[model samples]
Target: MSDTPQIHGRVEPGFEALREVFTTNFTDRGDIGASLAIYVDGRPVMDLWGGQADPGTGRPWTEDTVALVYSATKGVTATLVNRLVEQGTLDLLAPVADYWPDFGKAGKEHVTVTQLLSHQAGLPVPAEPLTRQELIDGTPVLDVLCRQSPLWEPGTAHGYHALTFGWLVGELVRRATGSTLGALVREQIADPLGLSLWIGLPQDRNSSVAPLINGRPDPAALDSITDPEVKQLALQVVAAVSDPDSLLSRTLSTNGALPTPEASTWNDERIWAAEQPAANGITNARALARMYAACVGEVDGVRLLSEDAVSTARAEQVQGPDEVTIGESRFGIGYQLPTHAAPLLGEGSFGHAGAGGALGFGNVTSRVGFGYVQNQLGASLIGEPRTAALIDALGGVLA
Candidate 1:
């Protein structure tokens, strides 16, 4: 309400440096509205949120304000899939056709659940581009995926599935569990843990959602960079994404199925109401951190997965030059592993970074679970600068 953003929430005694980093994000890093939470050994140590939830209306971000975390939703989806595996409802090594008979078609009879979750299934974009209406209805996209052929040999390489990963994995979960991904998320993950997380947000909670402010990179920013190597890398990324025929472009856009990443399409209530498990997860930092905390250890007598199950989910499934990103990437069953692309708290840290800057990760070695959500999307697809700074400060505290 004042000239300065009103910061809120608490931090444990040793974690004060995190608060300093969070404050500088508003003053220096251009963060409009954001929240960050951390859990150590399954208990919260830091919970912070601030800035304007709706700059247009002068509404400040509150503890309950949730933002749409793009690909960070993939980490949550992976958790559900692994939980099914832990319960024997789904098999990681079994062929996907075992659950969905239609998916075995188009030379994909041998693709396994592990391959799909790890992004090595070679089905990045559909053969036919889908319409926005088709994406909202959901069935048409699944049908298209069923008839689509792998762009590369299955399990030979990995690419970011972007949007299609949701439909591919969501349909598999539906056929195996007899419930939608969003329903399972609510029934199993959200309700039991009492978290304010959702894949398909309910209409009643729509008012609390923060609208994303696009932060697509500007070419002029390249001129301001002092380092030549960083500038060159940035230039190459710009070239790859600018080409409509490039793998990075086609994969991210799903061959034009998705609206431009900078567009306001994600802010629509209709999109929020639809189930897109790979994206469109509306949640705050507290729930994201707590969920990861439950995964690795226990939070309030609740553990999402056994140690063995967490190990299996975090185990490396693929690592190499990703065909889609045009850079090195790493993945486990469904989580992004530590790499230059997303150097999440060093080794034993596994989580996913969203399209914008939202990130969530769990570090097994340190017994830390971290989550950061923001209304203003950052330019970098991975290794978002604001989260990077917070993580750096966290490293200092941990050391």
Candidate 2:
């Protein structure tokens, strides 16, 4: 691969530094194919994409190329739920059983929508192992979640619900709106904002999706890091997540649903067609940024969430050492609050990072929305270095 990959897209005059950072990601940071986009005050400031869509086929990453954004889908899912809250269709404080009575089983009778969204409901993983077919079918997965008991007392602690969060929340949306989460994403959020995002991608659009080149961290890379503190932190994270019996591992894998650490199963079309609200969201950087931009301010006269709603969504709901990721973690209603794991534009910024490197977030203080998607998957449980570099450059530009 050439050190200088041909980069595409425009940057607003003042945001030229972002383009440089984007280019550096390919040349220096091991980015295979990726797109980065930013919007400030409801206007596009930077839109860039480059590298190969399929390195094997020699297909160049185009403006329309979309990639699966793993758990970054959580941010999008959070937006949908919050929108329902804003419209008075779903109440945050109401028991989830009010919508789906079966969710009330197994000591979950009192699990509120707020607690579930905030990752405080303690339904991190189902007790039994689930097959990929079962997950794609959706019904078997929902049945398992409804019957499983919480790992801890709901609202007493928090853990990342890597896979189950989708079914738990989607069931509520389904019962309340008589529509699937994917349909709501299109009718309520994507279509209104003119975004190319989808929780359940269509068959015709499948060809436009970029296949992921999944990977994990190299021990040699960690050993070579010059910063002692950074190296130690990286090593610790790798150890915790790699341990099969650890909460991080079980929660991420859904107790053997995704047995592989690399999770190459995501590359399958069947998974892409299914609705996994907490994961498997297919989109480009432009759509992701625009979606978040609308959250904080108007975009083309469309505002997804009002100022008061944004405030409520971003207000800290939980904080402390995370039981799943084993680090300091924080959350708002359904959005991830800024922490060492996900340093999303500092205070008043909320978003979620995926299992790989995908990220999307909106900052209320700066009226900024940022999105990044890539086919190259990174292993870092916390923030990936490539994203950290781009965010630092963006922060410099804002300063």
Candidate 3:
């Protein structure tokens, strides 16, 4: 790699710092291939990308390269739900059982749609693991979730729902609107905004998506932790995640259904064809940013949410120690707030970060929409240095 990575895209004059930060990511921070885009006041201010999309094949990341952004899909999913709410087809505070009666059983009778979207329904992991086929089929996953008891009382606590969130939201949407989440997204959001984003990726677009490169840290690296207690806890968390039967592992694996949740499973086109709204979304950073930009303001005559909807979605729905994440976290309607997992943008920014470093968010305070996607995975829950640097640069530019 050169001293300065050859970044391809334009940055508004005063925003030159963004290019410097983006270049440093490849030269200094091991960013393989990624793209970062930002929109301000409903206009594009920056659009940039660089590096090899596939290291093995030496495929260059291009202006149109799309990456599978794991959890960042949640931000888009939440946006879809919020759209329904705006249309009065779905109510955030309405009991979920009002739409899907099956969800009311097993102590979830009182759970509201907002609680499910905010990760407060305690359905992070189901009682039984669902097979990949079941996940693809969709109905089985919904049946299992409806019958299982929540780990805690609904609305009392918050935890990252992970895999279960998709089915919960998708089922509600299907019951309420009689359309799949993917169809709704294309019809309402993507078509209006002219974005290339997809929940259930179309067959023709598969060739443009860069394969994910999983990032796993060496276990020996843990020995460097100075605090004994912190080291032990970290190891314990790692152990739970590695164990096939553990809640974290099972939920991620869909009960040992996926061959490997992190990398291989997603490479399979079948996964892409299915609509796992919580994950498996594919899009370029520009589309992600534009989607978020439309959330808070107009983008090309399209506004996804009203000001009232934006305010409602960004309001703090749950905050405190998360049962699943095992740390202090915060969430709005369906988006992660500026919490430990993704403390980027600004005070009132809300978005979702993927398993690796992919993130998308809109800041109502600054009226800034930001999106980032990378094939090179990172090991931080908050974000790797590359994303942190770009966000810091953005903050400086805004300041």
Instruction: List, residue by residue over 124-205, the lDDT tens digit for candidate 1.
Output: 7777877887887889988988998898999999998988899899999999999999999988788888999999999999
In order, the Cα lDDT scores of the candidates are: 0.87, 0.87, 0.85
Residues 1-399, candidate 2: write the lDDT tens digits.
338889999899989988988898888778889999999999999999999999989999999999999889999999999999999999999999999988898889999999999999988877788886987888998998899899899989998887788888888899999999999999999999889999999999998988988775665776567777667776676887668777778887766666433546788889889998998899999998999999999999999999999999988989987778766779998898888656767997998887678999999989999999999888654468888998999899998
Q: For model 3, what is the error of residue 278's alpha carbon versus the real structure, in angstroms, after optimal superposition? A: 0.1
- Clashing pairs counted in every model: 0, 0, 0
TM accuracy, model 3: 0.94
Give the C-alpha lDDT of model 2.
0.87
TM-scores for all candidates: the values are 0.96, 0.96, 0.94
The C-alpha stretches of model 2 lying farther than 4 A from their native spots are 224-236, 259-263
Query: Clashes in model 3: which pairs?
Result: none
Per-residue error at 240 for model 3, in Å?
2.9
Clashes of 2: 0
Candidate 3 deviant stretches above 4 angstroms? 1-4, 216-236, 259-261
